[model samples]
Target chain A: MHMDFSFSYYIGLAGIMVFAISGAIAALEHKEHHHDVFSVFFTGFITAIGGGTLRDITLGNYPVSWVKDENILWAIFLGFLLVIFFPKLLTKLRNELFLFDTLGIGIYTVLGTRIALDHGVNFFASALLGMISAIFGGVIRDTLMNEVPFIFRKEIYATACLAGAILYLILNSFSTNGNMNLVVSASVVVLIRIVAVRYNLGLPKIKIF
Target chain B: MHMDFSFSYYIGLAGIMVFAISGAIAALEHKEHHHDVFSVFFTGFITAIGGGTLRDITLGNYPVSWVKDENILWAIFLGFLLVIFFPKLLTKLRNELFLFDTLGIGIYTVLGTRIALDHGVNFFASALLGMISAIFGGVIRDTLMNEVPFIFRKEIYATACLAGAILYLILNSFSTNGNMNLVVSASVVVLIRIVAVRYNLGLPKIKIF
Candidate 1:
């Protein structure tokens, strides 16, 4: 079944850039320990693509995400180069990181759900995939930084993505407008995240017994 | 499609303990940064169980590995308690980390292959699963620590796991006793790893331009 590739591609690319910038900003905090620009760049690249790659492989796709598209590599490299060459500019604009990351999560969630649906997976599984795609990279980033994953910590991370995926499926079942559904689903996630952050809302903590 | 549960449980338990210890040792180097023993223990728990959990979940096994047996959780907790109480002892024994990690790769690789085969997956897929099961936790740990994965960097990590899995399959085809085949295959991996570490042997890097 052929689908509209361009729409998802643009959304996915936007997600990558946002993830890259957030990763770079996170790495900047560790600048006191002698982190090179390359390290930050690579971290961003991994954060942007890591989760999606894992999702794709688990779904049994060959050549993986980064391998199949030269654009991904170029985007990552350019993202890093820009951050490296313009550290002051990036630092000043660091406040925008959360906004971009939230938007990225929204886009990635929709794209992941769409891909899973295309693969003939069930709705619940597609939603799961969507959340995984959206949050896995950030989880990887947090873990690498020796911190617990953001999803497992503060912020409405994976939950927002999951809600968005469910919304996407619900919209798709009732309507023939895929693009509108994607946008609506993504907007749902972005709005939820923004409100959650603004209100300091979060999931209940797991008790260790 | 019922399988023997007794052997699987013991093997899986041993695998968790081994992986947990390796995680503990890896976390020790970061103690100077105020990373407490509890953090170390949690890291160990995730490292030990993460791979198997991912393997089972992706393979469509509900309830996951640690969820099926509460012992896994207790084991990780006990493992952490021991490390916390005997910090100096563990510090003194740091040299054994590589040996323990190598043994972990062997056991997990064999166990993963066996489980995949039991599920009626083909040899190639089973071997791939084995490789994923063995290396993925470490990969996750490295990513969390902001280090490039060991499998992606120095040494033939995943390749050794692949070799062990293939050998297990070969021996099974030859009508070897199951326990004996596991031992032989594990031995092959352990020996390869020991030699690789001693000789600084590694896979040739893939240069992407």
Candidate 2:
């Protein structure tokens, strides 16, 4: 039980870092001269926390994740501090946002699947919940930014999370050890996202005419 | 039964029109000399449909408000057309936006309260949901424009919805007739909003240190 809780904690932290970075990058892109460091930091925090918060609220889990653990708050704070102190330097670095975002996505998907499975949800529902936990924050952030949701536009985002969630379920049937499952499931999400980005694989857009 | 459905329908239409006009006026206020028509139109549509759509989704109603009724769609379309065709004229008539938006706040709150009541939710939960339904869309629009959510800032927005919803429950206990009850509830919301805005009444902000 201790192992499971800590594993989820670490994975969730990593996910927050990634989502925050992505949000920061997006805010930077949106405003050329408006160096609103506070806005960027707030956006990052929202992006990281938004999806899981939605999942928990919908599932009737109160007190929320960041509220429960001070570590996640520190992570967001440090991330914001890092960006603020080194805005141009961090923004200039190539692929850092992508790297962290991919890692966060994978880790979050595994954590979500684990939580749903622990709650005794069915496989399909678990997978869907996992994907929701992973992608909904980005969707919320993008929508609030007046842009089409990132999941609806680019990258293999939702699909990547769903695939990883399904893979976690498959891995769990073969073994019940908690740590191995976390590693394996997170690896599945990470690998899929990496390959998808490399090969430029994504879902075909639904063309409304 | 027919009167109940028709009353809900008209209430929803009024909400949509008001929300759209509010968005258009907001866009006009955003820039003094330059008007971005597309942004205005997009914001208008989002404002019009946003609150009710969120309400339906969170309440687990599928296909959402606009999708469920074609008349709602037509209302949105007509609202959009009016704003798109007459941006300057619409901007000049800004008082109409407040009247319409307050009316929308009332109608949507009642509609949301009704849906929750129909679903057998508790009074407090129903009232809270009603407020969320009425205010969330405008919160969203403000956030997308990179501003603080309006409800969280200067307005007694959510409070108006909650007050109206409370009145709804109180009236329901006194009367069993649904149509009359709904009309009374909606009127209560509109009046509350108008009075609050006119008197500059709002919730006290909490200072966290």
Candidate 3:
């Protein structure tokens, strides 16, 4: 599959940047111990690329994404540098972080579903993969931070990704314009996630004895 | 690659079972909340297959092992059932659990290294993959349980796997007897792990302010 230098591609890069920033912020918030600069940088790098790495691996995509694209590595490295030099900038840019993170969820969800479809995986599985790509990085970051994943608690995060993936599949079936489908589906995910967070909407928690 | 239903295959199955049991025990030992049977089962399944899944994905090996083999699924399922029915049995079988877990580390290390070699990865990379396959499941299990990974903290777990992988590569180079190579490498890992636990030998903790 040929990927053009499209708007979605730029959005994906922005997503990577924000994810790395969030990861760095998480590391800083970790009150257990003082992590060295390398540990902080490693955590950010992993959080930025972990989900896509898993997606490519599951799909048997060769060379993986970051391995093929040095730019992504450079982007993450820049994020690490930003965190090290300006640790308080993250808090100051909280709203911007939220915007970029939500956009990232939408863009990653569409990208993951499209890749899986290209591999000829079934629709249901493709959507699942899409959700995994969008959320698993945060899952990994939270896991490494030794905390219960936020998605499992008080967020409609993965649910929004699932919604967007399903919407993308449905739209793709009718539309021949790939960019249109990408924009519509990603917008739906971003809107849903933003609205969910705005109104404090989330799935009911389950408790079993 | 043609896989014979050989002794190593049986050892791999046994490894999956023990890994699953350890995951269940971890879920039970979680102090924060009560996990239901499904939670216990999910944790066990992830712990049993997580490392191999990651390994196969990284290698771009399609139809990952668990996806191809129904028997492995059944083995893990049996482990889950055993845990659910006999929650107290783990405490009673601590010594047995330790024995099987050690054996698992040995077998998984060799299996991972052999698969990487089959893919034509260089020795160092193959050894790294071998260590990942041997220890990553427990890392996932521990992370999910909200603890610092045992391998990262106070254990010689990954060291044992690394040593075993190097031994396997050296043995394979010197001798063409595959079974003999497998036995010697796996024995080294198991012996190292057992001795480490018995004598409380571990890497020194690092602290950076």
After TM-score superposition, the amount by which residue A95's alpha carbon in candidate 3 deviates from its true location, in angstroms, is 8.4
**Two-chain complex of model 2, DockQ on C-alpha atoms against the true structure:** 0.05
Taking the tens digit of each residue's C-alpha lDDT, what string does model 1 give over B1-209? Answer: 12346654565566677678666656655422224433465568668877876777567654455544567777776667666666676567656656766777887888888888888899899999888888888777666555677677777778899999999999998975988898889889888888888898987776799
Give the poorly placed runs of model 2, Cα more than 4 Å off.
Answer: A1-111, A114-171, A175-209, B1-8, B28-38, B84-92
- Model 3: per-residue Cα lDDT over A7-54, one tens digit each: 888788889988898888798889973678877888888999999988
Q: After superposition, which runs of candidate 3 have C-alpha atoms over 4 Å from their true positions?
A: A4-47, A57-103, A120-129, A140-209, B1-7, B10-14, B17-21, B24-28, B31-46, B53-100, B119-129, B140-148, B152-177, B180-209
Best-fitting candidate, scored by lDDT: 3
List lDDT for all candidates, in order: 0.74, 0.72, 0.83
**Residue B206 in model 2: shift from native, Å?**
1.3
lDDT of 2 by residue, A5-110 (tens): 5756775686697778666666656633132444565567778788876776566453345544556767876776666566666656647766767778887887
TM-score of each: 0.58, 0.57, 0.63
Better of 2 and 3 by lDDT: 3
Q: Identify the superior model by DockQ, candidate 2 or candidate 3.
A: 3
Residue A2, model 3, lDDT: 51
| Chain A TM-scores of all predicted models | 0.89, 0.87, 0.95
Superior candidate under lDDT, 1 versus 3: 3
Q: In candidate 1 chain A, where is summed lDDT lowest over 10 consecutive residues?
A: A200-209
